[model samples]
Target chain A: MREKILKAIEKNSRIDLKELAIMLGEEEINVVNEIAAMEAEGIICGYHTLIDWEKTSIEKVSALIEVRVTPQRGQGFDTIAERIYKYPEVNSVYLISGGYDLLVSLEGKSLKEVSNFVSDKLSTLDTVLSTATHFILKKYKDHGTVLAKKYVDERLKMTP
Target chain B: MRNPLSNKITTIKPSGIRKFFDIVSEMEDAISLGVGEPDFDTPWHIRDEGIYSLEKGKTFYTSNAGLKELRQEICNYYGRKQGVVYNPMTETLVTVGGSEGIDLALRCMLNPGDEVIIPTPCYVSYEPCTVMADGVPVILPLKNENQFRLTPEELEGAITEKTKILILAFPNNPTGAIMEKSDLEALVPIIEKHDLMVISDEIYSELSYKSKHVSICSLPGMKERTIVINGFSKAYAMTGWRLGYALGPELVIKQMIKLHQFAIMCAPTTSQYAAIEALKNGDDDVVEMTEAYNQRRRFLMNEFKEMNLPCFEPFGAFYVFPCIKEFGMTSEEFALKFLEEEKVAVVPGTAFGDCGEGFLRISYAYSIDDLKVAIGRLKDFVEKLRAEK
Candidate 1:
């Protein structure tokens, strides 16, 4: 049941509750309650609307900052991950298993703003030893949606 | 110059749906809910098999009974899916399409003046195929109230001494009706009492929403008398591949293959190869596509209900037949005017048969976004008609 509900939501997040119920062959209230329970249990983390921001003229910058941290006694990478994720500038933080102990991604108003955060806050952490930041050039795709128009439906106007 | 056409062939009616398609083809900015074909491409793995067969230079025709491998796959698929076993070597013969399967089955069985009981509105070919095969086409108008299903009484009432065959298209076209096991069980006694052979077209079998399709052949004592016509088109998105097959008693399949050997030589070698792959590996693809089609079907049914258009809930096929009679327009008039006024195209119900007069067949094979826009346009069109009244 969870798999079906999750798949339906994954395909189209904005699909109506009534439609979700019909697709799963379940009662509407049951689908609603199941979705609510999934939300409460964190099985469904969040819903997102995919946008092709390249179409708009908005200016933005995003960067992934990889950091090598000293693993603390009992509080290893999780505590540092929590600290980095708590920052408003940080979009996501993972305790990565690589030369880098933590991988952080953040978005900013401009390149300068993103670089400033890396220098001023991320690198200034007590346990932080080294940091490497790579700025995103453009998003050809994001969250399973293609950001660019690569193909068009040029099928014959009618078919039997 | 004298005409070269045979009067019998020329007189057979073309699909009324094609006339609407012509107008749609010429018009720009038109959104069609008309065509019954799927929007999905044939899954990549199936296509890859076709390519692999070609690359191997396996392009020569197989025996008229089709490749033994493909026949085995077809037989195994039905044995698992419908619990009906057929001898792959003698009882299964592949054809060009489910269309050809119908043609071969009719042409093989019918003598001139024999009557074929066809429940309509049905797929466009049944009537014409019957006529072309020198059989009289008997149209049994299925009632919307009966959910467009052919009841046992309807079956018994249509049978005459001249009636030799019954054409059963479940997961029906235009109407989207299906006959469950119990529904089909009721017809068996009627069929047996009448001694009628059956041409059960189950091309849209995999698309049933309520449950898996129940083949009449799967019912007791029906297999020997029924030719179950199914193909990869509706189920595997392989319409362009043009591959279908018939499974039945050895006597019938032998003659059908003889006719196919002379007429078609064999079903396309590449398509047969691809169909083998589809049968072996395409179950997940069918399930995924069917689920997607169901979501669109439910959405449209809900939209129709909200707009107060009385639509029977269809559990099979990717179509919704909404009664447009309340708006005081014939199905064709409503469809044409809707296309002209709103640029949204749906088929007039009468295209399927005269009994389809009061309703319209809207295919939900398109994306949900397209269905939403078309439904909104239809709602506006209906509102305007009400205002004019």
Candidate 2:
């Protein structure tokens, strides 16, 4: 029943409990209660479409910018990163050592927009000292898995 | 006036290889074939030179680039063997190890957000180094049909305006694949057209069987765009000594030397002297070891065939990557269960990359005695598993 409900939800995110119960050969009230419980427990994060932004109407240019900044008198790296991260354009921020203090992953409509943000928004901050930007060529893997490949290929077989 | 907790300690996952190695370290009398390094001791002559250097009180740092003698020897070694000529003073910089050469090269070359093309199922350091360098690592999965070789098509596809450097770790790790001269010739035009830099890690150059290891810098019009990284580790069994060198355009070497000067003034003085001796008198030992490795290579391939595991015949290096998917588990699961059940250790292919998911890399650098023992254990383990099923 669980697999059936999951399958129904997977096929159609707007799946209703009555239709899900019929598909799973279960009672409607039980199915409705199960989904309600799942929702309450936050196991069902709202349904989302994997928008292929590449084909979407919005023009987005993703770039990774490395920023070197000193902390303010009372604040530290986390504070600085958090302040920068509040901007709607900035996607993520990582505090790294070596040459740069912060690595900001961001997206904008154009290169000029990104450059403008760096000059107007990022560098204008009290702590920001310098910035170097490198745009991404491609992302092969993220979040512990391949982003493109369907499955690992296996060609060999052995008999039991 | 500084805070007591000035350094915020960040806890990260321990390296998976070290995690497995630590587990194996606890097992008494385990015949392991897990490590990727060669089993042979550093050649006696090289060891003697290191001892001699220490005895002579040559403990101080050499030139920021490295000892002139060692660099000259490297120049001679490459020119004699691969027809590549590099000025010792300008084109060369000796590093802590090939590992350091890799790090320094990436650090010097990549501006933030630049992309470095790395073929998958490679040494694990490449990805982390790219991230640490603030460069994006674009992994191009090499197909099995290409003999695990990165094709010109793949190279062409992976390139973009942001692509900066291409890491070519030929006589590859994990898979014993070597790119032939013709194979490299095909890539030269593509690389040249893009005007991109190539970091070629040819540390296993001396271990090749069929054809000699070809330096990408040896190609016409490639010297300006290539940094050839080689070391005494795999060649002279000097992994512990930590001696490696890179030769390329003087400008790149200068930038790399600047970084090295600030961070590490010089590589170990003893290692440098020892490396000079290895370059001078190491070819015979390399030949003998390659012969030994070839024999083991044949044995391992035959064993894989008998076990009905498909394995491509590797031309260089000592690893045999065998597809182990038929056992009904991911590579990590299979490796863990195998080690638990049989007490034999091998690196799961997934540790290299996603393409390695169904494979397991077995190094044949151990003695014939250990190889025989490992094969017997493997046979027994497989039989027991089948019986249980």
Candidate 3:
């Protein structure tokens, strides 16, 4: 039931509770309790809308920063990742494989602002040895959804 | 000038859905629940395989039976999924689509005046195809009380010395009914006693929601007499790929290959290659699509209950055959009025056959949002009709 609920709400968290229960073939109260329990357990962290900000009039610039950081005494990469993710501007922080010790993604108003953050705040932190920042100019897909034009149903209105 | 059409061809009526399609096309801003195909695009990986085959210039006619590798994969798929084994080299014939497989099977198996028992409220092509093959079509009107399943008694009554083949399609189109193993077991003895051949159309096999679909061919003593027709259309969402195949006794398949060789030369070369990839790596894709369909099926059943509509819960395929007899109108009248008043188009059950009267075949292939909007209008229409009553 947990897996079913997560799979159902993964793409559309705003699904009606009653409809979700019906779709899962479960009692409404059981579904409600299951969701509440999942929320409390932090298995379901948060829900956010996926917007193609490029379609909006607002100016936003995004970049992915790969940081190679020296491991601090006992904390290793966890402390560094937490510290980087704590900033309001940072969207995600991960201890990554390959050449990078940590990967951070964030958005800002302009390319200049994003670059300023990388040079000013991110690189200045202790144990942060070097960083490579790559700006995102286009987003063809995000979070399993294609950000292209809306899909029009090409099938005929009626068929057999 | 002499008439160009054959007398036999002229006698066949055009598809009933084609008439309704024309009506719905002219209406602007109409939401339709009348499609008989999946709403998903062919999975990208499968499409990529097709594109890659083309890029490599593998675009030529395969052998009359189809690509050997694809035939082998089809056999492997059947063996793994349904526990039915076949010799790919001798027993498989790939065709343009499941529709073509149906035509080919009828043409190859039926002699003039041979009778083919077809359960009604099925896909529209069976009766016409049987007629075109010079076979008489025996209609078995399945009962709603039986949930549209073919019973052993029904089978016993329909059989005669002339009855040669029975066309069985489950996860049935328009009705969404499926026969469990027990259901198939009951009919097998009668089939064997009558020495009848079975053409099991399992095109919607992957979309079954109740349990794993049981092929009639898999039952004991049934393999030699059953021709299983399946394809990538509903399963992998590759309807436009035009690839389907049949597996059965080597002698029957040899005849089908001969006719297919003369008529089609081969199934599309690129599609055959893509289908190999589908059978090899498409299991996960089928599972995901079937899960989505099942969810939508449950949602529609619940909505029908809420609206007080009389619909038997269908456990296979993506259609709900809801009975609309209480409106004091025919299925056509209810459908037409519903479209005119609510601008939500659903297929009248009579389009499938006369037995489909008083029912509407509403496809749940659309997204849930579309379904919700369409059903909201349906609730209002039903309320108005009840108030008038």
TM-score of chain A of each: 0.90, 0.59, 0.95
Can you write out model 2's per-residue Cα lDDT over B238-282, one digit (the tens) per residue? 888988999989999999999999999999999999998988888
**CA displacement after TM-score superposition, residue A5 of candidate 2 (Å):** 69
Weakest lDDT window of 10 consecutive positions for candidate 2 chain B? B6-15
Residue range B20-133, candidate 3, lDDT tens digits? 788899997999999988999999999999999999999888999999999999999999989988998999999999999999999999999999999989999999999999
lDDT of 2 by residue, A1-160 (tens): 5655654576467755554454354678998888778778887667755444555689878888899998776777878888899999998899998988999999899888988998899988988999998876655655433455554212111100
lDDT of each: 0.90, 0.82, 0.93
TM-score of 1: 0.88
Clashing pairs in 3: none
Give the winner by DockQ: 1 or 2.
Answer: 1
Q: Which pairs of residues clash in candidate 2, taking residues 3 or more apart in a chain or in different chains?
A: A134-B113
Clashes of each: 0, 1, 0
Model 3: per-residue Cα lDDT at residue B229: 93
List candidate 2 segments past 4 Å from native: A1-160, B1-14, B386-389
